[model samples]
Target chain A: MNPNGQNAETRDGCAAKLDVCGLDLYYADFQALKNIDFRLARHEVAALIGPSGCGKSTFIRVLNRMNDLIPSCRVSGKVMLDGEDIYGAMDVTELRSRVGMVFQKPNPFAMSVFDNVAYGKRMRGLRDKRQLAEVVEVSLTKAALWDEVKDRLKKSALSLSGGQQQRLCIARSIAMQPEIILMDEPTSALDPIATGRIEELIGELKKDYSIIIVTHAMHQASRVSDRTAFFLLGELIEFGDTREVFTNPVDKRTEDYISGRFG
Target chain B: MKKRVFLDGLLYGIMALSLCGVIAVLGYILVYIFRQAAGSLSFGFIFRSAREGGILPMVVTTLYVVVVSIAISLPVGIGTAVFLTEYSGNSSLVRILRVAIETLAGIPSIIYGLFGLLMFCRFLGFGQSIIAGAFTLSIMILPVIIRTTEEALKSVPVSFREGSLSLGTTKSQTIFHVVLPSALGGIVTSAILAIGRVVGESAPVLLTVGLSRNIPRTVFESGRTLTIHLYYLTNEAVNPDDFGIAFATAGTLVMVVVAINTLTKILTRKFKNSQGDAS
Candidate 1:
């Protein structure tokens, strides 16, 4: 914690819950992340703020090994969660189960509303009808969508509005019971009202799960995240509590970015 | 705008007139064949082969050849399409495969027949057998199946794949579960088109299978398809009876094609309804 009652960089005050040490990522000839170091505490919502093409999404994707699918992508260094090195001899499947992701756009399966929420459980081989039903109800409730769709569980997920679909995607991630959820501009495609709903959902979600989000919206970072990390040119420029970083940023790049002085 | 509209209408008129000419030719052929053969299309005429033999056996042989050819070609062609469209990485090899497939598609059916006759029949010592004809037809239709299925698979949206992957499902599972189901309509349509091509083929069957008006009780035996029967009858008519049999056989072939089209439409509708419900 800081003089402003906010967590600061360069101390184990939050005990280094997720330590990204000397991380470097590359896409073929393009170096995306350059020797980055950052950390996230348990049950903390850390917002990554940067302009377009600054490698924020690339950095978060490294957490779940999603970037490995790209043929020319290469990652090095350590991403440790609770003292366990995530990239060291750990099964990718097991790693993904602990760390889930939500894309910028909502991607509900071409399935019914009920099945959309039940997908992860079914993928893990849960076949009991009653158990799936209970899981759907609980997850949807947590996502603030249970009442709106309780009567139409069998309806196509595509029939829902944009906001509802995004919430449904969040519900889907929640149903997997992951310890950490990575969101890549999850509300950028949404309207203000919808964005507000997701912000409320994220605030509630952080009580139980750690969240790392990349956003272009600075106000959103200030309102929703517990801490904020400002990035520029594939490097971490500042990492501190949301209020302190927004009100009193240390790095010149961070202050410039927050003040709308150019990306 | 007015000139462009006039030009568009003129092109549309020319196209429709050309298509109508084709339909008129087909209609005239049907009417002529029916007028000549309707009297001879009796139970005995159909259930029986040539007065030299019964047409029943010939009809059975055509069915056998078509069924066997479809059985062998459907799985292999589909597998090839899936591999080319989905599994193959973007490399010079895949480009070479695309080029090879295009070349195979352009090759004439007669070339396939000649190759089959020389290779499958002569080398395997199964000269003029139904299996020889089936192998020939399978290769001739291979390009059709591969091209159509590849197009169908490509028509599925990439968003469906991304959604499945985000859920942590593997690539194979996403393809099998989501992509294949969405492309089902186009796949069945392609299969029906292949069947139409197979049923109407005459020259290839003649060159490979030979003209035997006998039922193929075994795949290794020589037999004749309906088109081949019609061809031989038109060429070698010892009596007016043979001519009538050819007309009636042509009518039966047209009927078979129509029936296949109707069946495919019904199947596609049922599938769409079920998929809509599932989603």
Candidate 2:
């Protein structure tokens, strides 16, 4: 099964949708991610959980090369997206478009709701009015926000509530029709109800897109993700089915961290 | 408690007195000017030629200077500011440019008059015309516009840039579509401030734009601005009645500046409200 699966997923493909091998990230002298090997299959949800400064955010940023914006940031090892090296021969903008990101804080551009949802496509030079309208409607609907925002499409995105704004951010990502979506603490800034709504949206989204989320909540990881990877001090300590990782004994640190001993 | 209350009351009383004192001084100037101009501020005095007691030539010349100088300087100033704030980050060249701009802003207006007289009037052979004055005033206001616009661009939130970029837009596109539009209000405010400076400046206008009383028909022809006309009216007055004309000219200058500032404020408010980016 291993050889046949690896052979079939060899060319122009990953063993999973994304494959990272011995990834090391650095910010000048600081080693942010020491060495990480991770994988995400198609149409699945993977949650990255750890304490603060555990490099979960940095790890996902490398997936889309978002760290390229920081002057002092550097990375090594292979990050393969559909079997293509993200750091070699691939344009940063193209990589970003294929793997869209959502920040912890809802960052909808200070434009109308229609413009905000259509921002990704518009930036890529999609200017046809009817096409843009359709994309906006579909993306918003998929993010479960079209009904809430339909009447106010011309209103400023900033006028929406915090949860709705977050959903708009999700819609903005989905508008790109990305192969994978990276969410960095997407709901850490939201209230409980907003967080629950996002967690539910993630459940709906995984059926269509490979989703990677970095979360602080233990239950969010257990409830939303099929696979959970516990990171500690930039090292991947445990990776397996979310149920098994949560319930059974794994490494001491993973067990201790999950049992509320220490992060 | 009583001592603290009494001291706080005294402090506020002193501040209020200072504010009233400032307003009283301004009010006194306006009252005195309006009284002096009562005899000279009729429509005929404004519509007739300078030879026939009207200052229409000066008014036209002032308009030319404001419009031409703003047209030349506004784009250059905004471009330089965008480069400084959005592109150059914290390089040594940028540091030097920032220092140079600060020095330019701090130089005395009389010095600018001397430089303009040498550079535009004699060296460039514009020869003390409205064109010369417009060039000088354009240079004079560059620092003011650049400094204010850079501040405006910096005030745009970091999240706006991140939001635009993470969606796969180029850096320049992010700046133009998101950051620049967000900073438009501040840029307009900067331009208004430059207009105020250009309107109030007298020495530079007097040096580069000559005190010609003729209604000059072209920018190349020598003409006098309102500030220069007012200066000449005050300097060469032979009769007490002549002083009335100077007062009227001053009043006209005041009205023009007030009208420009008010009109722009209303216009920009409407613009920002329509775009829904003011907040």
In lDDT terms, which candidate is top?
2
Clashing pairs in 1: B48-B54, B48-B55, B49-B53, B49-B54, B49-B55, B50-B53
DockQ, cand. 1: 0.31
List each candidate's DockQ score: 0.31, 0.49
Best by TM-score: 2
> A101 in model 1: Cα distance from truth in Å?
1.9
Residue B203 C-alpha lDDT in model 1: 80
Task: Report fnat in order of the candidates.
Answer: 0.17, 0.62
State the fraction of real interface contacts model 2 keeps: 0.62
- What lDDT tens digits, residue by residue, belong to model 2 across residues B1-279? 999999999999999999999999999999998899999998787778988989888888887888889999999999999999888879898899899999999998888888989999999999989898889999999999999999999999988888788899999989988898889889889989999999889998888888888888889988988888898889999998999999999988887788888888898777656665312
Clashing pairs in 2: none
Give, for candidate 1 chain B, the lowest lDDT window spanning 10 residues.
Answer: B270-279
User: Taking the tens digit of each residue's C-alpha lDDT, what string does model 1 give over A56-136?
Assistant: 999998998888678899999999877789889877766776788888988787678887888777777889988999999
Off by over 4 Å in 2: A1-15, B1-32, B42-48, B238-240, B273-279
